[model samples]
Target chain A: MTARIYITPKPDILDPQGKAVASALHDLGYQEVSEVRIGRFVTMELKGSGSPENRQRIEEMCRRLLANINVETFKIEISET
Target chain B: MTARIYITPKPDILDPQGKAVASALHDLGYQEVSEVRIGRFVTMELKGSGSPENRQRIEEMCRRLLANINVETFKIEISET
Candidate 1:
């Protein structure tokens, strides 16, 4: 199975990198760009059978190591390979 | 309009960050995880009309600044806010 995780900064958090990108876009004549938020996208391949247990384990992985829950939130999508 | 860009390392590239995450998952008992890849997810808000020209401009931004073409590839998704 394959799983994808998206980790994004919380709405209230300051994202300097995103701000820099937005500024750069404006400088490049893309004046329409209003805001930008940068985050992480993670993809994983699992070897064992696809079961509810494995899915729960993957979510646990996100909470434990894949995301900074204090300032970020994560979403997971799983599919067959 | 809102746009999302996903930037990921090329498959052939070495991703130490992904490796570290996989190792951490293994340590945490997620032994089923076989491989992992980490990338960037960027969300942007645009103030102007969502035209083909604006979409093309966004793609240009990805090629010129948002992604390192040599080591990474990017995908863009656009939608109304």
Candidate 2:
């Protein structure tokens, strides 16, 4: 199984990296872009099959180390293929 | 409309950051994790409605700036909601 996690900044938080990217986009003529928020995309290979318990474990990992619960939000997707 | 872009390193690439993260997770008791690869997740708001043309434009952006064509691959999802 593999788990993919996305950690993004809270909507109210300021993202300097996103701001810089947006500004760069504007300079490059992508004027249709109004805003951009950057986040982390993490993919990990797990030892076992996907299960409710595994999901819970990944969620715990996100809360403890993958995300700054105070200013960031996370979503996890686990799949077996 | 809002678009989400996920840029991931090519499978053959070495991801030192991911290694560090996996090592940390292992130290924190997540021994089930065997491998990890980290990337960038970007969310952007656009001025126009979601359209095929808009998707193509976003893809071009990914090729030119958001992703390094040499070592990364990107997936884009555009939606009206």
What CA RMSD would you report for each candidate?
A: 1.2, 1.0
Best DockQ goes to which candidate?
2
Local accuracy of candidate 2 as per-residue lDDT tens digits, A1-81: 999999999999999999999999999999999999999999999998888998999999999988899999999998895
Write candidate 2's Cα lDDT for B1-81 as tens digits.
Answer: 999999998999998999999999999999999999999999999999888888888998899889998988999988897
Off by over 4 Å in 1: none
- Report the CAPRI category for model 1: high
TM-score of each: 0.95, 0.96
| TM-scores for chain B, listed for all candidates | 0.94, 0.94
lDDT string for model 1 (B1-81, tens) is 999999999999999999998898888888888899999999999987668988899999999989999999999999987
lDDT of 1: 0.92
The clash numbers for all candidates, in the given order, read 0, 0
